[model samples]
Target: MRVLLRAVKQIYRQPLCNAASRKRSIASSSEGSGLLQPRHEKLIFCSTAELFQELGGNVEVRTEFISEEEESAFMKELEQGLRKKRYEFDHWDDAIHGYRETERDRWGAMCTGVLERLRTVAFPKGSTLLGPVHVLDLDKAGYIKPHIDSVKFCGSTIAGLSLLSDSIMRLVKEDDAAQWLDLLLPRRSLYILRDQARYEFTHEILRDEDSVFDGERVPRQRRISVICRNLPS
Candidate 1:
């Protein structure tokens, strides 16, 4: 009986040991991926204070969204298990958004660092885990019209981790003509659009095969964005 118990313990330990080993491997591999390196000649690091000071509104940016190795592994897991799985839509009277429950154990474990980082940022009080992280998939022609987020129950911050593809997020002022500011959000990017950017402007992702900027056409790719925000009260 003692031998059998020892054997069971060994089996359990094997998985834990393997998980640790895999994490080490992932960390090492991420050091080599270009994801950690800045993409452009000028790197943009936006903090809440800087956003308010410069834009006269709240917005922040973190260049490294997730390690490429981690993203590749997660994508593999998603493609194997979560791909083509349709999730329910959270619907209001007129607006609609897709929702999916992330693999909580994995997501929580992986995103702990991200959440910790956010805690240091300026966020509203009474914030709680909004829901399971959701993968918001937008097709070639799919678009979300301008609207403010629902912050009645939770804090006003909405964090998105871009995945799978590249896209643009446009913020339009609420003035007579509704002027716009266009931001190009790349894959594996973290975007925090809140405060005035959230309430005073309408944000949208246009439906198009390509986006044109300065006479250059940027091709669109299928996009999956992971969103984390507080639940509505």
Candidate 2:
């Protein structure tokens, strides 16, 4: 058996608390839906003050960062066609959509709303600048192969908010596959990758595997990921 690292052991050592579960209600597909609205589902996070993990060297996890209402509302907007039509990128296996600040028409305003939420409430301490928000839609079989974000285009820190389902993120060295780590990312959680993680390691998710977390076998579910890069310095 692979020896579990300190970060992995520390995370499992903490008592697992039930996260508030509130499933988002999918609105009927409308060709022309306005801004995304909040549906207000109850959400919960671990009872601990904060959950942190050092897996893959330089990544930190904040399990259940956004509240139930916040997550539900965000999804409502996304599924209601507020975002640009979903498109496929040859480089990515999953259908991806995003809103950028530069495009000042529709997506720009929508993306700015996301940024405002992160500033006023999400961080709680103070506001942090984030780049364009990209939404990753994964089907039951959807998974991302190992890869790294380009520091040339984005800041060193990358944060992603998980919605809808639980999944595993496997981190591996680009040149050495033997060195790897597994992270259990629960729904509504926010994980940030930076420093070595942003610059050195490549991250991947297995195609719908039973992700093991704290000795429990958690099955993979269809998930949505909203990724935002750090504001450029």
Best by TM-score: 1
lDDT tens digits, residue span 1-233, model 2? 00111111112233333332111111121123122223211112221312213332255555556657667776676775534544333333221212111111134444456556544433324334453466666666566655565555666666777788777776654554444545566677666676676666666555665455434555777677777665446
lDDT tens per residue, model 1, 1-60: 000000000000111223333222221111222443322212222212222244443555
Q: After superposition, how far is residue 79 of candidate 1 from its true place, in Å?
A: 3.3
Error of 2 at 129 (Å): 4.4
Question: Could you list the CA RMSD of all candidates, in the order they appear?
Answer: 17.7, 11.5
Candidate 2: Cα lDDT at 204: 59
Best by lDDT: 2
lDDT computed for candidate 1: 0.48
Measured against the true structure, the TM-scores of the candidates, in listed sequence, are: 0.62, 0.59
Q: What CA RMSD would candidate 2 show?
A: 11.5
Query: Which parts of model 1 have CA positions greater than 4 angstroms off?
Result: 1-54, 86-108, 118-126, 231-233
The TM-score of predicted model 1 comes to 0.62
